[model samples]
Target: MFEGHGVNRSAAERRAASLTTRRSVKKAHQAAWLVNAIRCIDLTTLSGDDTEGRVRRLCAKARQPLAQHIVEALGLGVVTVGAVCVYPTMVPHAARALRGTGIPVASVATGFPAGLMPLHLRLEEIRWAVDQGADEIDIVITREHVMTQNWSALYDEVAAMREACGPAHLKAILATGDLSTLRNVHAASVVAMQAGADFIKTSTGKEGVNATLPVSLVMIRALRDYGEATGHRVGFKPAGGMKSAKEAIAWQILMKEELGRDWLEPDLFRFGASSMLGDIERQLEHHITGRYAASHRHSPA
Candidate 1:
């Protein structure tokens, strides 16, 4: 449907900027928003040096994203992140750590970050991660497909990856930074949904320009259109470069205003971030005690 879709860069920037400036939440409401952000975060650890120990620690954080004191102070019950995302090899570690926590283990498969590997091998990677107990699979798309406007090729690749996921939910990472234009981002979003992606992600978090407000806006609009046409609900995740509770609120506001409150839940929205939780914790503490704690007080996420 987005064959010759046009995206006005200036208008997108203006609208994105307005979301942050025009909306404000305070005190208890801000704290509530921050807690919701924690619930919708895909706590991630995808570095080259990721060890079993690090993955286990990250899962522990995912299970209890907020401090016990913070949870008690906020009068909350059992607050945990939406999922624990790790490399394919680290899925076992995360799964074991979060075994009884009811949190899903997500793995980045299909030649993640660049997705330059052969198609069959990439599909095999998805099956392997699923075999290793990944409840969700985040696969990167071939940016060349979008750049070349080969929608059929993009849909076929993503459809193959979806089939390979078995019972695992599939998240298609568009790596919008590399797509080169907002129009490409929108087209890619539609094609991925058509191919059966459970979620359309903004980036792999490895791109120089990962997730940005304007990029997310374009993707969300595409998702809205898809949901309208097909009556299917696909999730939206803005991964990378989003750090701070302010961004957490901004993105949630975008989802709420554009798609309504249903998109505010963890099932339909997530922040693909590792360090974003730390800042959110700091903000919650400030709301409770009227002073910001040292950043060190919040454990590494």
Candidate 2:
């Protein structure tokens, strides 16, 4: 059954609150987890001022997220981010910069952040991004569909967008903050996955309320249930407002608890962030030297 399951808001709230209160990895273990978090970051740049040069620099950073010295001190080799995300117009720039690096280039399409454009135009944007050598496409679902309880319409739209992605992976951004209720968020997650979303993402980063623990609990449970029912695993991405190393650890703990360690990989979980990498790097430096570096020392660009 593809119907959405009901969510208990109070219980979900309790669980979310507990997630923050629970102490997580620390010292060396925390550093190691931060390294893993770095590997799972979709280092993103989605500003209106984005340019080809900016996208290229973002790709370069993705290739070597940590300084060579830091990587060597950690006893690691060439630790790169999961992917470099950019706008459709900069896909070619990112592709050119990341070629032969194994790291994929992800482009946000389907009128991202708003997704209020016409369906045909949105699908066309996906095709264009893929054609421009985007290995993954982050698409925003039409919030109006979910708001109006138009599940079938939402399914059809996401299915078409997935098809438009062709060989490239499709990540459906639910814009959960705009979905009104936890039940609506659950329903949208189910509909997107049923229609063929490779991953169900939380926010567009433009939302006023983005990527909260309570909302994450709702969506991840949906992922767990979908996996149990269909035996098909889908990925989860929590974007926006996830800035600190502590926030990253909280999300990692959520995945570990709900879906086990198998969901911890870059393929199954990703942090849609741009500033997050800098903080993780800073914390890793502190782990090594007991002193945090200046923010500019770990700039994303």
Candidate 3:
């Protein structure tokens, strides 16, 4: 463990911290590689879109060019779909649909995008999702606790969430927009990393202010420092409001320059974009045929 006291413990911690820094300085470019990757292939895939006639339209989307076009783009690999995120209720269907495919099913949990529920219930949600075969679970930290500067409570709670996660990866959402400051984001990132977050992600995509490059830069830099201060290999995910090949590449460049090459890997880095897939197709089309083809209207595109 990199955290401890006493002369011997301190020396060991220093060595571990040093090793971690050097490795992150090396892997920052790849492990956290920003996949211009995508999210929201199906509009109805988004939660809170429920309406009386919504299902009929969603069923239509499944049959039309929307799903086909999106799938075909995923096939070309000019881009990568970060993960296929869906509502808790949709995890089973998404798991079945995405099975045998390389993409991970990252399901939002912990009464997600809100984080206003009790601890036991939230943990049960994580347990249930993992049992259903969800590959990843994205849970937001309790903003109220964070606001009160209760590090011990926050750390223990996050640790519990981590234990509940078991094998399924935990993408701890800082909900940067709500936290609303580079300093808080940095502190939260450090705490989340310490608490066993596989990846520290930004907002839940339901927030108005999602991932910003500047915010991403701050978050990644903080993670870099934390990784240096500790040996654990924590990752970063700048989700929400991400769209466009240019945007992904820009963040990729940022990760490479600021964090180093190891940050580029899919395991370490990814984007959570509901509409970025269309932008990828447009970029691909330009690459393949040298024309900026107009994307058919779809949710988030």
Candidate 4:
């Protein structure tokens, strides 16, 4: 799945030891191998295809309808809805619709992407989304504060979002694109988990650079190590830029190779992507049709 592993255990180990200790390495590798994904896409699916002309409209007219279509298309199946990543305002909409299917509706909150808003507003966003029926909240740690090395405010914000979540699952988006290195990403993952994140995600899916095996590997490694230190098993969601089924499988391959086989399910792995559905569809077609054909949306039978 992962094309092939270039995992230098020695290199990975050296990095992992910096965050906590060598103990975290085992499971971290497992997570990296398994939960190869938390499949997701944003509100753009409400309407429009991927074209420059629709760029404005793609962001527009998109709301609950788009999410519902994806839900219906997913139907009840083995492939899974992963988690529906929507704006805080749409969480309730997704929850009401996807309820009983066991598909968690994840709302991106706490002033997603930019992290420019006040903590109270962000907390309110998370609280409101939970009120709307979100089973999980994908939150952004304060990137501005993190950039400033203002650990106080950043940790406070993460803790605040943590408290606001109150039993709802939390996936902390460190927005790693802003962070400078794999070391920084590893460190962020550890801090986020220590501050109470149930999962450490790589991006907001808004940035130019999104999830990659290298970045994901670092975060997963961090979580694994953190788990050993504290006895908590964190999850991973590598959002944005996951473009194909091959890539999705590569994540699985990475997990299987780097960590092991334990972290391969929806509980541990998630692929955050809007484009993945088509890729999955195409692959599914190759299975059913005997040849690879173009893919498109079909009503859920």
Q: Each model's TM-score, in the order given? A: 0.99, 0.97, 0.76, 0.74
- On lDDT, the stronger of 3 and 4 is 3
- Local accuracy of candidate 2 as per-residue lDDT tens digits, 209-270: 99998899899999998999999999999999898888889999999988999889999999
- The per-residue C-alpha lDDT of model 3 at residue 243 equals 68
Best by TM-score: 1
Please provide, for model 4 over 204-231, each residue's C-alpha lDDT reduced to its tens digit, 9 standing for 90 to 100: 8788898876677777777666767777
Residue 82 in model 1: lDDT = 92
Q: Which residue runs of candidate 2 sit more than 4 Å off their true CA positions? A: 2-4
User: Candidate 3: misplaced stretches above 4 Å?
Assistant: 1-44, 50-80, 297-301
Pairs of residues clashing in candidate 1: none
RMSD of 2: 1.2
On lDDT, the leading prediction is 1
Candidate 1 lDDT: 0.93
lDDT ranking from best candidate downward: 1, 2, 3, 4
- Give the alpha-carbon lDDT of every model: 0.93, 0.91, 0.66, 0.63
